[model samples]
Target chain A: MGTKRTLEVELSTTGLSPDGKPQRVPLVVGGDGGAVALEAPPAMEPEFEGEHMLINIGPQHPATHGVLRLVLELDGETVVRCIPHVGYLHCGFEKIGEYRQYNQIVPWTDREDYLNSIGNNCAFALGAERIFGIEITERCKVLRVIAMELSRIASHLVWLGTTCIDIGAFTPFLWSFQERENIYNLLEGWVGARLTTSATRVGGMAADIPDKWLEGLQGFIRTFPKTIDECERMLTKNAIWVGRTVGLGVMSPVEAVNYGLSGPMVRASGVAYDVRKDFPYLDYETYDFDVPVGSAGDVYDRFLVRVEEMRQSIRILDQAVKRLPDGPVNVDDVRIILPPKSKATSEMESMIHHFKNVMEGPRPPAGECYVAVESPKGEKGYYMVSDGTSKPSRWRIRPPSFVNLSAIPKMVEGHLLSDVIAINASIDIVMGEIDR
Target chain B: MSPSFTIVHPGTGSNATPVTPKNVPVSGGPVSPTAEAVGAQFPGVISRTVVSRGETTIIVDGARVHDVILWLHDDAQQSYDYLSDVTAVEHRDLSLPLEVVWHLRSLRYRRFIRVKVLIAKGAPLEVPSVMDIYKGADWLERECYDMFGVKFAGHPDLRRILMWEQYKEGFPLRKDFPLRGRFSRSEQLKNALAANPEARYSMEELSIADAFEELPLDMRRRLSEGEKVGE
Candidate 1:
């Protein structure tokens, strides 16, 4: 009996039992030593059944998307519990914002959500303008709309590319990043910086779009969707992609709202809540676009919603380019908007205004305002409190990724270890925003 | 206002499509009607109602804020189902009270309201946690605690989130703390160099492997003395 058992029995770690014990498979040796018979694994090794294992995935790992560290407790390959540790990149942007002027904080905003720096700059500028009681010109509003949409496209592209790499696809990563580079070239032409483009001021944009910048934008708008189509063709129906993403990290509508999810994260759970549509800032309400929502609230649904959002953003960019009115890019107020460099060099009053604006900064009334925008990740908001000074008393960033990442423990329960990577990628977190 | 444009406000639902607000006054616009409703239902709970830059802010009694928030979340008409943020503000003036703010959004009605609690200087910097109402408050509350040293009484795990658990420097956001940090660069570097790599694994993780007992005695003593990894 012992010789037969030793010859016929083989253990395989393929799956887990309902009770969380590691399931095994046994291969029966051929009766006449000619063929092997598959049989149910025999239960043994009782001591090993209850011993859970602990594993750590990041802090320095590439799959985490950032410096996020996840400690998962496992029963065989099934995740029993997951603990996430963040803030390895904490630089205290909020603390720093308290010491800097409202306009000075724009660059810091660029650093927080580095992937969406221009969008953050627009958000901060909008919040500051509200506090300063300066309504921007129509042209500035249109430019900000363009800036935000372009930033959203860049950010969503990064999410798509990195998530593909995480889920064992390589081609889409290259294609998405190539398009992202085109966006960077456009940004560099406008702001002279790519990753941290501080292209916004309190009253208006830092500079108007250069000659033929619109042509570059038109080129991108015309050709960018093809890349999205190509990536979709590769992964949307791929069996391996579907198997890895579908039905993983599911959150019901009610649960998604309770978790304070926004952007594609909440929209994927069938909630039609969009800050642009609901809260309506930067004239987003006037633009015609659909808010993509998903029914399943799974990773695959999130991917679909994000892809659809890129198309919707293109629609918005098209409308903005067509309707962009001609006017002064900056407000007429000398208190906030600096004088033109050419005028500053010649006119004494303009030079004085420029000196004062740069040195003292614009002082907002003693008040507070909370301005929220539909960032690519979610509802990004800036809460500014002023005490009748150039510097803000308190500057708080309502980072969407931070709140969205909080739901990971609930999402990863009962999932396999490999699914954790997919779920984390689905969160679309930037450590700069989370740790700030 | 033109009849073609539908005004966005509470109780209007989907029939009233929101439009981008133009010329929002710096102060004194229409306040959120929920402020009065909250004030009427929870008498003496709201201390002050302020409408600044077109957003309504209600300062509630610190002890009763949890009840107000729970009611605001559970009520059908005032369903502020989303907890957008949880943050605290320390004023530059030393005499002012610390303000703990909660930003709530009602997706169905398209309304946003800010609820604030003022903790007087020298008073216990603590408030009841709303984690029960919004599970998303877990990290927000923890982050508020980590940055401001404000305690959320009922939070299941109110630990330092961004900063390490054993970080001895005082709350960085406190007005009194220097911008450069509490310690000099050399001292901070010395402390970082002295930290043991094995100590970074939290006791919760170590307990599963039963590896705590095998650690060096001094390290065990440090961990046992309430020094642990991040939350």
Candidate 2:
């Protein structure tokens, strides 16, 4: 009877049968009861062979933008793993802060993010204000906002110029620099120095904005956005530019958040995390501006976000100029900020105040505070730990470039080696801030 | 009225009650709950609690640094996820060679805390590494290691960051290290050559090249003749 056997099939839910239920069920073959053979699943194997290659891109390469070296593990041209080797330009700014007085450290902050010197100054001054527990005057706040916004425009111009040059667009560099030169001229008129102003003091500013300087700033604010538009018109719709940047180095919002990305990087990823809005300091709440955000977290989004941010800065600058009050720029608190040079020379009381302020310094109460500001690169924060002394017991900076640069590996991994340069330019990292 | 006034005592030994104001409040109005909580948890760990200028600081024992840091990071109440920086101050004359400081911040709480570890002068002075918890601490720890020579146990790579390649055997940031150039002219030249092989030409050859490059035809002949006379 053809062995007269019944084929069995297993039916299991919990990998076991209930009492009285058979472990295997009977199956019938075609026209007769019979056993059937089943085929086993195939073994799996790796599709590709060979080890990933390690490539050192830069400590001294043109695309790095600074003295940045990236150690990349490549599977052919595609990057597998990337490790950024920082400290090639370590300045030890925090350690230097310990030796210098509160006001003396302002110039050092300028050097931290040289492109956004005014923003750095604002962050440091805001931190000092928090520690000193002094309220800034209305005029001082407006002045600071105006200065910082102008500096933001300048910083974005540099980024655009350098970034364009990186992508082989050379004309924009000269065009962007021309406008930046105007902003620098205005800044120089007010602060006496172009790059490292050291203009903002703990309580307020070193000097009031000169009338001519204010006129120049107002004139520049009106014209800056038109220039930005011209820049955008040149590159925004260009097929080649879009092709190079649009879909490259795409990072999700969740990945950006987890990686501690901030500023344009986070904004480009559709996250509305702005220090100005979230933790408002130095009267940033009063400013009328929009925080530009993008859907796709790509190099192009980052570029667009920065470009839009420059327009927003110009808007803030215009508002700041309009609302700028005419009065004492600094607070009456002589203990925290310095007295005017004229007052010091003329009045005996002012001389005594100056002497006391200089001799004793601003004795911040024993406490720690972290004050962050929206720097052109990202959230530039100063973490000051006071010990009721003239000098901060511990001075730490949350440099945006440093934190944003950390996301390099995530951005560059799985991208081609050639695309790495474009990604680096998009981030706009300054090695001074990174290594500090 | 006279500038100076004399006072007479009723009793033979002058037992007078101190004149005090009734309206004055005492003890700076109930210490900050956060500061008190930190103090209570540590239990004799803190040497002093300072509350002035709206800032609160608790000085913790240096020996119990790792324990304190672990508590700060792990404890739900104090989740200091980010290590802002690690810096050190050198006091050569004091008993401790270095006072290592760790600044930590909690993004969730928007609070900051400082932990200091004092290390005496000597080799093998070790501080527990926080790189295991916060990866950001790696560079900061390396920086501390490089500047202060304070060893951080389990640091991936602790090496000098800012100083020159041949800046061996001395921590330049320390108060003791000379600020000015330490090497002689010949030593500087040798070090420069060692650092960059491309700059292999000697000063004499460089001078000759500069003379030929900068001088006019007539001036070059005169300079060569002068050099020959000097030789």
Say which candidate scores most in TM-score: 1
> Which prediction has the highest lDDT against the true structure?
1
What interface RMSD do all candidates show, one decimal each?
Answer: 12.3, 26.6
* Model 2 local distance difference test score: 0.69
What local lDDT score does residue B60 receive in model 2, on the 0 to 100 scale? 71
Per-candidate clashes, comma-separated:
0, 0
Candidate 2 ranges with C-alpha deviation above 4 Å: A1-56, A71-75, A80-83, A250-255, A333-369, A385-394, B1-128, B150-231
What shift in Å separates residue B202 of candidate 2 from its native position after superposition?
A: 29
For all candidates in order, the CA lDDT equals 0.86, 0.69
Q: Which candidate should be chosen as best, given DockQ against the real structure? A: 1
When candidate 1 is compared with the true two-chain complex, its DockQ is 0.37
Task: State every prediction's TM-score relative to the real structure.
Answer: 0.89, 0.71
lDDT of 1 at A32: 24
lDDT for residue A284 in candidate 2, whole number 0-100: 71
Note the residue pairs that clash in candidate 2: none
Candidate 2 residue-wise lDDT, B1-231, digit = tens: 111111111112123322211212212323434456667787888776654333345567766767777777777766655455566766534464466777665544545555666566664568887766666565566666766677888777565554433444366456565443357768856865554422122232334334444434554565466532110
